[model samples]
Target: MPTPSEDGNASATAPTATKCDSEHTPQPQSVCEPDHRRSVVQNVVLIASVTLCMIVNTANLTGVSISLPTIGRDLHIVEDKLQWIMNAYSLSSGCLLLFFGRLADLYGRKRLFLCGCAWLGVFALGCGFAQNEITLDILRGIQGLGAAAAIPACLGILAHTFPPSTIRSIAFSTFAAGAPVGGALGNAVGGVLTQSTEKSWRSAFWFLAGMAAVCCVGGAFSIDKDEPYQLDDRRVDWLGAFLGTSGLILIVFALSDGSVAPDGWKTGYVIAILIIGVLIFALFVVWERYLERVQNGSGTRRRRWWTPPPLMNVSIWGRANGKLGVMLIIAFLQWCGFLSFSFWITLYYQNYAGLSPILTMVRLLPMNVTGFLCNVVVALVVGRVDLVILIVIGTTFTAVANLLFAVIDPAAPYWAFGFPATILAVFGADFVFAAGTLFVAKVCLPHEQSVGGALFNTLTQVGAAFGTAISTIVFNAGLTKASRKYGVEVHGSVANAPRPAQLVAYKDAMWAGFAFPLCGAILALLFLRGVGVVGHKTGPKVVDSDATTNEKTVSHPWPTLLLVYQAVEDR
Candidate 1:
């Protein structure tokens, strides 16, 4: 065996290597370089494994919707209480995301990711054996906590592993595609499991548990090991975590409970909690700002108790173009539309259209299929096109789809309104999600990438919760009114209600749903019109060469806007 030397020479008698010189010495012949092919294979495995985890988590989010009615009947849960099953998961996940994201960055991403997977599996199994609504909801909330821990860590790993390039863009796009894919699969699989007389709704949870178990074991081997970054004196912001999580949970509780409470929003408890939630959120902002000031003032000196760094970069809020702000708003609105429509439409198909669970899945399958295809298309053109235009087009399609559903006749053929609406909704959702995620990854600084990813997912989960809550309120109110008008008891799923009552409730709720995407469209037009990707040119613009030695001037923003609009129209 030959010994290695510092000067790339193999010598029988090399001078004894000192500690300082050893750092530069090449390894002996027995040591081998990393195999590029093996590393590539590992990267592929890691991507697939992380993507599977995402699919399961996202699937659980929506898969339970189709099973809600069955679960309600079996567990003897009331109409209003059934909403909690879904809300519990979303609210918990949404509230805890920021805290967990920061924790992952401070600790270890792979460790957190594995622990989260384990938590998900355990809770999912608990849900399978749940005997009542309370048990199910509690277990679901824990499952969501697991999702909160895993999702951002997985994203951070991806961002850290893949450098900023087309590869990263494609990877993010592929990961984003999991949202629609899992959602669609969740609907389809949940329907299948719930429809089976032998397995029933419990089988869905078991299925989730199985998938999570697979992810945990696979992730343990596939994910690369990385050490936690050292932060000398910075600490986790426990106070901020408490305030923010509590505030979000309380707000979601108020929203979900508003329609069910005796006095609605006027109920003293509801009103009080709502106020407290808003106040806590306000306090959270104030505390974070104060911490920022303290950190700035300290300048290199460590304090005994200083505010930890914020979950998100405060500067992201002040970007001149406001791209991140626009993206977040758009994400919130899009999920609001998507979740409400998906939930209510499932009810519409099962109750009003008299479709079986399997049949409902069949009806909804087109949207998922279309969504997957559209995601592939978006990933190909994302870098070349203006994302704002894509957003506008997507929101427009979503608005139009909701409007179609609002006016859809109970007796309409599958081809007339249902099919077209599903297609449009899928296209709209896939485009916004895929493009928005890629855009966020591109715009964020390397250090804050995980935070950015967490914020994006937080908006999504929060938006879904808000959408579900608002839709529940509107649907319950409309159901109550229709029941009173028809002199029937308001005691069952809207699907099982009298035809007249069902129609009235669904149409009213659909009208409310239409407003969300419309608002998204308006916001995009107003704020996102001039924003472009960070590194991409904003179309062809006239430049003033002598404006400054270091700066280039461009023509008016109107031409860029026009070009984007034209491009969208042409596409």
Candidate 2:
């Protein structure tokens, strides 16, 4: 935001005043990355590097999921505890995202990204060597901290590396493609490794470790360096950070582990923790609001030295004709359904159908294949088609995927229901991911891209965790009810349960997943009706939110930027 101080007008002071490499001549205070600083090759390599970061983190999550059953059996873990394998990762990553997102914006994205990669790799290796369930879960949770940092940084870099344009949209689509591709590959490769008695499922962690190390090296070499932060929002909101991060950790922990508690949700500890978490979260919001008001000059122009900017930039909601705000809410809802559906699909193939891990992988291959094609389609259509159509249709596909599987008979041929469901799942997930990330790149100011990326991912990742928790709760309840009907006992492990009860449990879980995305689509259809045409909003790096004298709103920038972009887009 303090543009000319670091990157701008030192060159202007020169007597000769030679023209810059950029098409536009250098202005005293404007900021522009010199075109000559990055070659076309550098840009491609940078994209590849950042995209690989997304792939590895996503694959790390999905790949470990397919191995959950295997890990449970080997580690003698119960069915209830097995979900922790996934929840722990999601919890750590989700809780820490906003903190690291802001950090990347202030300190540097490339720096945070590289550090995250190295941390992830080391811990992934630790996970490979873990001897028991507790050790593995602990390692996995720590590994997710790396993901929280790296993902936001990756998105932040993409936002700056390429400005808003059709080409940027395609680049974002490629980046978005990483999630489905990683999920698909994680399953295929995880299955191969899991089915083997030699490498076993632990090898999946090792594989992730190796890839993380590779990506770290590539990113360091490719990502462009950040300018000196001589002037920026360097103040850290220590109290807000503590409240926000700790509150989230407590809430997600309660949601994740509550179902398995001795007395379930009624347990005193669970009730206490949940209540405390909610109250603390409320306080965090109040604190952030107070800081925002002060910073925006509503209360005082000379803010206290202790005060700092809010963890999340509030104006992000108004970007893109207020579509960005709705999109984030939609992100949570759609993604809540996504990973849950994928997780159950794996179990449906292996646990229900009695197929080997490799065979399960084969059954799921169609989804990944479709996901690849869907990525390409989204890239092609995102700029050409109306975004509202793409979002609603894509979200609906995911809901349908869950519904189809919910009613399917395990004895039925794969082609009858499973084939279409898997394919539909990919299309739904990929489309939403590409469109969502592209909007972020276009909507967020250059300085706030990391926080924007973090906000989007915070919803999506936390939604995944919440979805898993809900499915697990519904699943356990269904198993108990159906087991009673079938005159059987459902234990901590489903392996010993009756076939009828297990089948009913899977369907119940799938139904929960179905409801989530359906809600997302309805929300989109209703609120997004007034959304402006999806296009890039280009402007200065930093604009004050609310100006004094009440003449201009300086505290929010997107409101004005939206008008500017809409005017240009209309023409």
Question: Could you tell me how far off, in angstroms, the CA of residue 224 lies in candidate 2 after the best superposition?
Answer: 3.5
The whole-model lDDT of each prediction reads 0.70, 0.72
Off by over 4 Å in 2: 1-31, 34-45, 158-173, 300-302, 314-323, 438-450, 536-571
The C-alpha TM-scores of every prediction are: 0.83, 0.85
Top model number, lDDT = 2
Name the lDDT value of residue 525 in candidate 1: 83
The deviation in Å at residue 109 for candidate 2 is: 2.4
Q: Lowest-lDDT window of 10 residues in candidate 1?
A: 553-562
Error of 1 at 38 (Å): 3.5
Error of 2 at 75 (Å): 0.8
lDDT of 1 by residue, 260-361 (tens): 787777989999998999999888878776665555454554444555776555555433346677788888998888777887888788766778788888
RMSD of 2: 6.2
Counting clashing residue pairs in each candidate, in order, gives 0, 7
C-alpha lDDT of candidate 2 relative to the true structure: 0.72
